[model samples]
Target: MLSPSLPRPLQPRANEVLPARLALSAAAAAEGIQLLTRDFAPWLAERGRANEFRVDRIPFADLDGWSFDEESGNLAHRSGRFFSVEGLHVTEEGQPYGDGPYADWHQPIIKQPEVGILGILVKEFDGVPHFLMQAKMEPGNPNLLQLSPTVQATRSNYTKVHRGADVKYIEYFVGPRRGRVIADVLQSEHGSWFYRKSNRNMVVEATGDVPLREDFCWLTLGQINELLHRDNLVNMDSRTVLSCLPHPDAGAGALLSDVQLRSWVTGERARHDVRVERVPLAGIPRWKHGESTIEHEDGRYFKVVAVSVRAGNREVTGWTQPLFEPVGLGVTAFLTREFEGVPHVLVHARVEGGFVDTIELGPTVQYTPDNYAHLGEQGRPLFLDTVLRARGDRVRYEAVHSEEGGRFLNAESRYLIVEADEADAPQDPPPGYAWVTPAQLTSLVQHGHYVNVQGRTLLACLNATAVKGA
Candidate 1:
């Protein structure tokens, strides 16, 4: 073997340089080198027309290379790769926050333990940071195309399990020649739909010349921020990766200190007891497998269905897979209130059955109104009405965004940021709720499993829109 050489410096030259650069990028609102801000939507539409994309719902028997196992009744690929649809039984105990002392539910969950990469490549253009983004097509998306990250790929796709074309710009995230890692953390997905699912949310700074593809463009963070205000433009993966970017500590002060916030979250997790187990999908209760879909008896929650997808630009030109389609639109919002002139958002420590951890910080209101229609007015979630009835003047930001299109079909949530008063949401809120500054939430997002996927998306909205409480 050759003689060993000295390693490079363990610490970077500038300890806090990346955050400052990111702040500069966040402040830059103009269009970047390759794409104009106004043309982004039109360009995405053009890309949609360039491909032969089709998604037709089919029965379980028509799925190609995919089938339900005769033994377990789990819907999976024949190769035993990618993800599988399995049944989950969850029981919550010990002072559950919303419902009662105890609660339980049975649902189908997507189980994909393999960690995927959701990365955004950053390269400076003329002293300003510009991010590499892709116009990707997902069959389950309402529009079938959205602004995605530079590289969004599962282990099976990146590892060539599908025997398809290479994932573009993946080397910058994984290989030996990978760029300088600015931010990298494992972030959770929709805990309600997925079972302990997490992806590697990464942002890397490219040091060398990078080639551009037809479907990819370089955008400043501010441009992305402007685009975020639009409906279903920026995809969920891009938003989550953007949330991991470091923010400056410019807040005047927060109601809760960072240590207090962490302690509160930990307390929330410790007080709740949640037990979950995987069961065969063959005999899950309250669900029936029909010819076209597996649906709930009451027509609430979501259903699992199969689709045949054909796209020209994807790694694999054509494929068939299953998607979880929610029954109704969801409303996910954060109620913001000013404390000592500092803006703080109400964060609810929510417990979902599929979370690896017992609980994660969710938005002030995250629910599908239709699912709770049976409960009537008294049973409606707290602050949900405040979000729904807020006038235009009190609404700081509002947009309709889709969930992970790769797994969800038309799963749209009306995301909002509404101003609230002490009368609406008190200073000393009820248990399982706390007011934290956006910067504090951003700090927690740097680590894994602290905030849920919906929380991250709202945090990204605050970061992008720079919304300040009046």
Candidate 2:
């Protein structure tokens, strides 16, 4: 047995260094490599059939283990382990910069203080790093089946609070005999829909013999990068984990130095004063709770609706829960431009009521256009028109991706990277915007609460498409 008081080394041996191996795999990746499996779409369909996955919207009264608390009107599970739907009252003192009309509003937010695990396991095959991915079913995904991490579970899930099947490959992430930890960090989730929510994003490298399940498959990093260009092929959890991988090099120089960029983000957080309060969900103003849903009076934003899920491969085969459904398709894009031949993307310091830190670096524009149509030209976001009206020649990358499928219903966003000139987006842009290299953003993502989920997704895209030798 190993000594409990042994001093550990700070760094791995030179041969075991991770970045070199990752770069090797990434550089060798081709757009259409058929090494492991052929046609992911058909394989996903077969898995769907094997799992007998099904989800249907049901009345609140039909929830099996969930009920509306009589005292606070919050929707929660009887065990109080998974998550709950509560109300948040936000009050912004000044005219915060954004497309939304109100600085103050009341809405239902998912409050899950527990930090769950979103881990992806990696192994070497013929000296190339291949990631283990699962064909998971989430009720909120538009297609109902997408590629997810090797082990995605809540504290309640792994702890057996739901009293279901054991999470496969979980031992590789949690126990003493677990795999080598490549990347492990606590990252934030959807701040708008979740109250101070965060999940542990991890990447582990397995060492010993592994039992391959029918629902799981191995693909190289290069293959995963190619899949990133496709719409909703890789789930949000996988994207966030991939973004945390050590990048090769973004560029030699940036418009703003790393110190200056840090100062700017700090100053953005200091300038805003937002007050948020947790209130009873029963009688929140401007929201009406019907038997089937709880939505805004104007039919904008999102609503809380109940769902019944039946999956053959989950920890639990059947369960009832609630999911947040957005009103329309959202647009999330990065405005990229070269400064002295060094590529940089515009980032916005955005504020959401449910965020624990009050602000995070988001994309240049992240909003549903339909939600802001009534605001007209004067109320439009700074670069919304530019992204929406860009010609084909200026577009770099475009794909439709969905949010966290387990808790969100059809919350898809048209993710893009649109090039712009000085006339469309100036160097001395609006107050809340700044330009930073993709490497700088990835550096910040290594820490928590710095880059939001949307920004991370775009950064992953940049790593795959824009960055040379990345």
Candidate 3:
């Protein structure tokens, strides 16, 4: 439990202006920065020399005690503690915890004893808000130190009984004077993927001069947005939190009014409907669950496999969990064009089985070739071909980046940005799709609607200057 101490108000800094040249060069990360990236090591070393920061990776074998059951496909702690697998539970009747159509399916859930806290600290600088971010390393991440939240701690790390210390800055979140809660939502992890249902995500603003750690940095919303354009620069946790930032309607540059966009979205909701039927794991067509791996008959789409992880920063140094492995690179693309001088991305209303909301906003193209081919003939996603084959001057941004390394094993995708002519874009897009401006999308992101993870990731990749000019 956090100490119930009142936070002191933040004091103003003498010179809040950023240096003309950043110590960490974004150009050095042009080839995609990660833990293993050559340039990243030097940059980190420089920061380390100047500040007190350290990151070390530990192998699962070096962890205290852990075990895996090949027969039952269960991963457990040798001491019978923390998280463990309790086999598969089949729910024929809908349960209160899960109200989705996944009834009657064999769902594998990790019995975790503690819920984690994913909180972001915010402060005002020069009347502009800035979020305190960390360059933290996770065992599963491809890059060593992707941008992470100020305080990301599981129950074990934060509680005195577990790790014997409190998570830093957690008092700002759980204790009194938690500042104005900008975004407080219980966002679920991958439902079809992770056993952990929802992690508490919160964004709070404090008005006081807080002590700075060597690994932490304060970034304006604009600067953070600029960093989003780079591949694998921002971690999934940060992107999800950024997706929840509030956007006022007064500064929008779109020709369409908020009422008009809302009306269009409402009409789209009525136009398309999604139905997900839960089938038993054993009965799933062509899928075979073996002692070690789960795969489809065609050897495509995705496979589930267990992996042991060790991280010095985490509460527990060692643990095992099943990760999702894709057959090939997935593609997520957005087609943007000027909408009365404001850039509007072609958004799709997509339905994922794991999502609480049946339909959420996604990019114009979000699919793998194998999944796209499996969508039958007519069920294929719209504008996928156009985006895939997009070439010449229309291609604005294209990069191959790894997925969330924590949950996904060796999963990556091609994130694309394409420019289209308004005249060429469809006036009457197919049901469940809309052309929403960057401002409108930002507003929707605040409400946790109109944009899904894939969409938000792509939105983060938008060039601020390019969008402003468009």
Tell me, by lDDT, which candidate is best: 1
Q: How do these models rank on TM-score, best leading?
A: 1, 2, 3
Taking the tens digit of each residue's C-alpha lDDT, what string does model 1 give over 233-310? 899999999999877765449988888999999999898888899999988989988877988899988999999999
TM-score of 3: 0.72
Model 1: residues >4 Å from true position, as ranges? Answer: 1-15, 99-102, 250-252, 467-470
Order of candidate numbers by lDDT, starting with the best: 1, 2, 3
- Candidate 1 local lDDT, residue 343: 85
Local distance difference test scores for all models:
0.88, 0.85, 0.60
In candidate 1, list every pair of residues with a backbone clash. none
What is candidate 1's CA lDDT for residue 127? 78
RMSD of each: 2.5, 2.4, 7.4
Error of 3 at 354 (Å): 1.1
Every model's TM-score = 0.95, 0.95, 0.72
lDDT of 3 by residue, 392-439 (tens): 678888766666566566666788888876454675566566788766
Worst ten in a row by lDDT for model 2: 2-11
